[model samples]
Target: MRGVVMYAPGDVRVEDVEEPTILAPTDAIIALSATCICGSDLWPYRGADDVDEPFHMGHEYVGIVEEIGDAVRTIEPGQFVVGSFFASDNTCEICRAGYQTSCVNREVLGTTGRAQAQRMRVPLADGTLVATPGIPSDDLVPSLLAASDVLGTGWFGAVAAEAGPGKTVAVVGDGAVGLMAILAAKEPGAERIIAMSRHGSRQRLAREFGATDVVEERGAAGVARIKELTGGLGAHSVVEAVGTQESTMQAIASTRPGGHVGYVGVLHGVELRGDDVFMTHVHLHGGPAPVRRFLPELIDLIWTRKINPGRVFDLELPIDRAAEGYRAMDERTAIKVLLRP
Candidate 1:
């Protein structure tokens, strides 16, 4: 099989690799129908995160089950499925509490190899994979794929931010996750959704996703804009989708004293001051999104055409062009890139 491998910063290649097989009874093999690049993938591509050795890349995927281990029962050959980036035994105590990403027995996909390939192995099949009602049309594939990661991450952000009826919500960052956060905020009845975006294209999409206001500012200025829109009280909930010191601080500062801050960005070089947080007086929560917890509802929504999170995919290419997909996203020329294997 052929997949993406990162040898170093700005050096991505499509190369031959060994195929995957079920090494665990809980595992299943999937032939990828679709996969895509993620913002987090850029961390190493840009040298922001160390890549001491060449490794596989990509996590978000939607595919068909080709084979299942003896222990796997719920899913079978020919069933289309979507799965979270983090594989977990959903029966764990933490998973039962809706934090599958932190399950006692958890495994991250793509660490062993990339998901941007013709086929891959999924462990803990019964717990980690969600089978679609049936094989979906090609049009629905992208949106279903988004539920595997970004859509779920955004939903988690909204839930963590406490977005609901009568609440004013603000989102920092305009990436795919942030845009989907805007959509998630809307679904829960947020009274006002403020999107912080400097890009015109993103701002337009944010409005379509239910952003009532767009703040084309950053740092203190951005905080001020959010406060101004909220009559100086700040937003009741703020979703931080960019894992930068500036965006984190901006999100913390943009919330009211008693508001909540849900940060989902993969932290890059962030360190928070204790005193600063103490003064802010806001509840903070977020980590690897428990995507499995929200997959059912999100899938239902997508299956019914209630939300179109797949619009985030501004570029689509063959799996052999995975490097171009990565470059398009890194250069900000594309919001998200979809690769067909």
Candidate 2:
């Protein structure tokens, strides 16, 4: 089988690799129906995160189960499923509390599962994989794939920010996750949604997803703009989808006292000032999104065609051209790249 491997920063290649096998009674092997590149994949690709040697890449996936271990019960062969980046035992105390990403027995995929291939082994199959209503048509594949990670992550960010009716929401990033956050905000009937973005394309998508206002500035200027739009009290809920120091600060500063801030972007070199946060009086919540907790609802929305999150994929490429997909995303030529396996 061929899979993507990052030999080093700026050096991604599709190389033949050994196929995955069921290594645990709770595991299942699935033939990937679709997969895509994540913005966080750029962390190591741009050399932000360390990479001393070659390793498999890609985490977001939607696939058909080809085989299931004897112990697996909920998931079975031939069923189409959506799963998150983390493989977890959904019955754990933490997972039962709606934080499956922090489950007691959790496994990291993408770095270990090598999902950017034709097939991969899913750990804790019964807990991690959620079967779709039925085998979907080709048109539903991308949206189902989005539910696997980005949609769920964005939904988590919005929930963390406590977006809801009669509250103003501000998102501090224009990436796929940020855009999805707009959808999440709108789904819960949030009013006066604001999206902070400089790119015209992303700005348009933000509005399409329910953003009523757009702020082109960033950092302090962006914070000021958000306040200006909110009548100087700041917004009631702010979502930080860009995990940079500047974006994080902007999100916190853009929120009013007693508001909430959801930081979802993968933090690379972020350090929050204690005094600043102390003075802000904002409720903070976010980490690797408990995507599993939201998978059922997100999948239902997609399956019912109530949302079109798949439009986020502006670029599509064959799995063999995965290096190109990474370059396109790194260069910002594409919002999200869908890789056909």
Candidate 3:
């Protein structure tokens, strides 16, 4: 099988690799129907995240089950399924509380060899995978794939930020996750959604996703814009989707006292000041998104065409062209890139 491998910064290649097989009874193998590069993937591609050794890349995927281990009973060969980036036992105490990403027995997909291949192994199949009601049309594949990661991460951010009726929500960053966060905030009845973005294309999409205002400023200016829009009280909820010191501080400063901050960005050299957070009195929460917890509802929404998160994929490429997909995202020429294997 051929998949993407990152040898170093700006060096992604498509190469043949060994095929995957079920090594554990809880595992299942799936032939990828669709997969995509993620913003997090750029961390190493840009040399911000160390890539000491060449390794497989990509996590978001939707595919058809080709084989199942003896312990995997719910899913069978030929069933189309979507799974979270982190494979969890789902039966663990933490998972039961809706934090599957922190499950006692969790394995991150695509660590050894990722999902950006013809086929891949999924651990804890019963707990990690969710099957569609039936095989879906090709048209629905992209949106279903988004539920595997980006969309789910955005949803978790909104939920953690307490976006709901009468709440004013602000989102930091204009990446796919941030855009989806706006969509998620809208679904929950947020009274006002403020999107921080300097890009015109992203601003347009943010408004379409229910952002009532777009602030192009950053740092203190961005915080002032949020306060101005909210009559100096600041937003009741803020979603931080960029993992940087500036973006994190902007998000924290944009929320009203006692408001919640849901940060979903994969932290890259970020260190929050304890005293600053203590003084702000903002409730901060977010880590690897518990995508499994929201997969069922998100799938139902996508299946019914109630939402179209797949619009994020402005670029699509063959799996063999995974390097181009990565470059498109790094250059900001594409919002998200979908790969067809």
Give every collision pair in model 1: none
Please provide, for model 2 over 125-217, each residue's C-alpha lDDT reduced to its tens digit, 9 standing for 90 to 100: 989999999999999999989888888989999999999999999999999999999999999999889999999999998999899999999
Q: Provide TM-scores for the models.
A: 0.98, 0.99, 0.98
User: On residues 1-341, what C-alpha lDDT tens digit does candidate 3 reach at each position?
Assistant: 99888999999999997799899999999999999999988888898878999898878889999999999989999999999999999998999999999999999763343888899999999999999999999999999999999999999999999999999999999999999999999997999999999999999999998999999999999999999999998899999999999999999999999999999998778898898889998999999999999999999999999999998899999999998899999999999999998
Worst 10 residues of 2 by lDDT: 108-117
lDDT of 1 at 206: 94
N/CA/C clash count, model 2? 0
Q: What is the full ranking by lDDT, best candidate first?
A: 3, 1, 2
Candidate 2 error regions (>4 Å): 110-112
TM-score of 2: 0.99
